[model samples]
Target: MSNVEIRPVTPADHSVWLQLWQAYLHFYDTELPAETSALAWQRFLDPTEPTHATLAWRGNQAIGLGQWIFHRSNWTVSHNCYLQDLFVQPDVRCGGVGRQLIEHVLTQARNAGSTNVHWLTQATNHTAMRLYDQMAKRSGFVQYRHAL
Candidate 1:
């Protein structure tokens, strides 16, 4: 595997970011409305928005993507980082891109003075779980959602 360069998304990265983002949505068998996707991309570029995204590049090719948001936590005075999305190209899995993307988020969270960096995945996402197991402790809390 070649060296992977992970960096925050810039307007010039829109095309590559969309490719990775679409692949991520496909992996979960999900789809978002075109408007929603556009909004998300715009939010990532908005400095006032707490949402952000990063891409892992191998040479000129983008191989992974990560999206996170910062928010206040009732339990702490500092901000908390929620890693909302993570995906690595199928051919590059297990080659360290995913971990690098995650570490990028952690570093950003730390620099922002966030209390913690956290994420969630379905129980069936075994491959990612393996790496995650080595990176952080499980919070042991079940998530309950009330969607509008």
Candidate 2:
């Protein structure tokens, strides 16, 4: 973890981003369309796009990914950013890669005029929940999702 570095994701990072993204999918036991990944990668690099992400690098390897977006907030006094996806390779979990990625995102959000950053994770994701719970105050809110 000594050489781990977290930086904004760019279009030039397609291949390495793919590796970490695929590992994230494997962790959730889910399958995603390749086109969707490509689209996301492109959108992240588009400065006009609302959603952007950062990739964590450990030496020459991409180790983690985080996708976040900003929008007007009714709860907060000002706009805020929502972290949509955050994942790190299981082999290197809890080694500070994820933390660094999150911190970097926070910096980005602040630079974007966002007053707060928020995100959600599966309740069963104990390893991630541990880190998340310690980062910010956990509101007792429940989420409901409906698949189209």
Candidate 3:
């Protein structure tokens, strides 16, 4: 962990980013259009885009990614950060990579004066939920969605 640096995602990281990005969607049983992924990569590079990405590195290699965005929350009357995607290489679990990414994002949200950082995961993803439960209180709001 000492060697790992969590920094902004760069344009050169596109190729590796796509593989991890796609894996994250697959793990959730979701399909993301390649074009959309491309747009997200581009958005990360664009200073004007609200999108911000952080990549975890152990020296020169990228092993994980966290994509986050900020928006005003009417309920909180302040901005909030949404950690839209977080994934670490399957081989690297329990090495504190995910925890570090989460902590880093939470810090970012706080530094931005955000009321909170939030995200939703599949209810069946117990491993992830367990970790989240430890970090924050469960909001207990049932989630529903319909794909058009």
lDDT, candidate 2, 25-77, per-residue tens? 88789988999988888889999989988888888788899999888877777
Q: Give stretches of model 2 more than 4 Å off.
A: none
After TM-score superposition, the amount by which residue 85's alpha carbon in candidate 3 deviates from its true location, in angstroms, is 0.6
TM-scores, one per candidate:
0.97, 0.92, 0.92
Q: Candidate 3: which stretches are off by over 4 Å?
A: none
Q: Top lDDT: which candidate number? A: 1
Error of 1 at 33 (Å): 0.1
Model 2 has an lDDT value of 0.87
Clashing pairs in model 1, backbone N/Cα/C closer than 3 A: none
TM-score of 2: 0.92
Q: Write the per-residue lDDT of candidate 3 for residues 8-72, one digit (tens) a residue.
A: 87778887788888888888788978788888888899988777999999888888999899998
lDDT of 2 at 36: 94
Ranking of candidates on TM-score, top first: 1, 3, 2
Q: Which residue runs of candidate 1 sit more than 4 Å off their true CA positions?
A: none
Q: Give candidates' CA RMSD values in order.
A: 1.0, 1.4, 1.3
